[model samples]
Target: MYLNSIQLQDPNHYMQIAQSSLLPMLKGALYYTLPLTLITFSIGLILALLTALAKISSIKPLQWIARFYVSIIRGTPLLVQLYIIFYGLPSIHITINPFPAAVIGFSLNVGAYASEIIRAAILSIPKGQWEAGYSINMNYSQILRRIILPQAVRVSIPPLSNTFISLVKDTSLASLILVTEMFRKAQEIAATTYEFLLLYSEAALIYWIICFILSIIQQKLEGRFDKYVSH
Candidate 1:
């Protein structure tokens, strides 16, 4: 009878914790996690485009600089990058808030990785496309802006979308730096309730649901883009 009673109470306890924690966790995701991903991805995409252009440029110095940047970022673990920005920087008397530090870390990491994707997309455009643009008396800038980028954007969409989804998951790392994202909220609740498994599971479910919705949106966007390209 005692064992059965304990078993009966366990479900109720977990349910109560879930009911109480869900709203605060959702608010954390909405207010912090989503915004962090969106802002960092936007900044990262711009940096990636510029870095890709630099890498492909004829100027040796520009290519060297871009290559060095990409190499360093790709070589290091992202958690170390976050730690250096948030914690190590204080040793040099440079202190950044948790949110900005997260933004900077994520943006730089994304830029290095995404630059390669963007570069590859640009290169995938046939040499004939450039020639055709030239045949029409289009200058290099005009050709790139009007002809090359449009096709590159199309080719790059799928990879970039995947990167965006990954970033959404990666924002959980921000919690370590004291950013009160969903996972952080989960940690807080778990710490108090001693329901680590339940709260963390709840957080994971929320993340999965968010990612699932994003995946659906990604598929729709891909289909729309494919139709446009086909037409």
Candidate 2:
């Protein structure tokens, strides 16, 4: 197979092999990449919100826990984190499958980074806003729900969108843990046919296309959020 593929390594034939590989690679994205990103981001955002709030809370223990979590996650490499979850945990008999492990690892990684973004956005609000809400008889929860979160969301949009875009790209790392995402599919095809360059380039192109579409959506969302501020 290697010799056969090498014999056809001319431009036209190379492209044909890559083109044939495209559909499977793309299907991997649809099934694994997109779903992993969406699920991980959704969970991560929730974790971020909680961690951000805990960091800002007056309670000392919550603050410490939040800080520690952010510190550990941010200080480590994501690949190592994934390894701990997928490979290292079984030392204590806590084992997880690859997809779940990837989800958990990516969520923690995104959560830690996103928490700082959210915390900064929340802190950027003036003290006067809290006072104003209090003057109107609003409790902290009510004010946070009605006033603070809405405004903070606008401020958080750009960075949070950026984190999400990064997450989309980072999902490729899931393939390392045995999740059959697009990059993994490319690797499999390349291994069998010994067409590493073409297959890898094709995979990169697909990732670029996905990220490009995400950037466009980010801009539109930012514009829409801006309208709310304008009024």
| Model 2 lDDT tens row, 1-231 | 777676544788887888889999999999999999999999999999999999999999999999999999999999999999998999999999999999999999999999999999999999899999999999999999998998899999999999999998999999999999999999999998898988999999999999999999999999999987898
Candidate 2 residues lying further than 4 Å off, grouped into runs, are 1-8
Reference-based TM-score of each model: 0.96, 0.95
- Which residue runs does candidate 1 get wrong by more than 4 Å? 1-8
Tens digits of per-residue lDDT for model 1 on 1-231?
777676444777889999999999999999999999999999999999999999999999999999999999999999999999999999999999999999999999999999999999999999999999999999999999999999999999999999999999999999999999999999999999998988999999999999999999999999999999999
TM-score of 2: 0.95
Q: Evaluate model 1: give its TM-score.
A: 0.96
Least accurate 10 contiguous residues by lDDT in model 2? 1-10
The true-versus-predicted C-alpha distance at residue 57 of model 2, in Å, is 0.5
Instruction: Give each model's whole-structure lDDT.
Output: 0.97, 0.95
Best by lDDT: 1
Name the lDDT value of residue 39 in candidate 1: 98
